[model samples]
Each structure stands twice: as structure tokens, then as C-alpha cells.
Target: MKAAEIRSKTVDQLNDDLASLKKEQFNLRFQKATGQLEKTARVKQVRKDIARIKTIAAEKSAGKKA
Candidate 1:
């Protein structure tokens, strides 16, 4: 998802998305450990996406506080 798309979502929605992404990240790591991962690039992608969601979420929260 793009930053713009993430920004459009409410904080609750962002939190939900973050939770699901984290779960996926965990599953991806498990797959890698088991040597069953097909697309290794997915690990990197999920990491970046989690970071993106976090960055945007923080920005939103800070904006609200300020």
C-alpha cells in the first residue's frame, strides 16, 4: 500500500492493518526458517510495508497531538 492510501485510513484501521502485517511478517520468518519460503523478497517487502504503516501512523498521531 502507498503512503497516500495509508494516510487516508483512520487510526483504528491503521492499527488493524499493522497487526495483520506483523502476523504475516512472523509467518514469513517461520517459512524462511523452515526453508519453505519461495519468494524470499517477500520478507523484505513485508518489513518495508510495516515500517511504512508505522511511520504514517506515528505522523498521524503526532499531528493529532500537536
Candidate 2:
């Protein structure tokens, strides 16, 4: 997902996306461990997406506080 797309989401939406991404990350790790992972690159992509969501969420929270 693009940063601009992520930034457009509300905090609640971001949290939901974060949760699903984390779940996918876990499943990807499991697949890797079982030697069944087809797209190893997806793990990296999910990780980056998670980070992006987190950064955006933090910025939103900080903005609210300020």
C-alpha cells in the first residue's frame, strides 16, 4: 500500500489494517518456516506497510495532542 493511501485512512482504519497486516506477517513467517512460502518478497512488503501505518498513526495521534 502507498503512503498516501495509508495517510488518507482514519486512525481506526489504520489500526484495522495494522492488525490484518500483522496477521499476514505471522502467516508468512509460518509459511517460510515450513518451506512453503512462494513470495518471500511479500514479507518485506508487509513489514514496510506495517511501519508506514504506524508512522502515520503516530503522526495523527501527535497532531491530535498538539
What are the TM-scores, per candidate, against the unseen true structure? Answer: 0.96, 0.99
Model 2 clashing-pair count: 0
Looking at model 2, residue 17 earns an lDDT score of 100
Residues 1-66, model 2: lDDT tens digits: 999999999999999999999999999999999999999999999999999999999999999999
Pairs that collide, model 1: none
Model 2 misses residue 59 by how many Å? 0.2
Tens digits of per-residue lDDT, candidate 1, 1-66, equal: 888899899999999999999999999999999999999998999899899999999999999999
Clashing pairs in 2: none
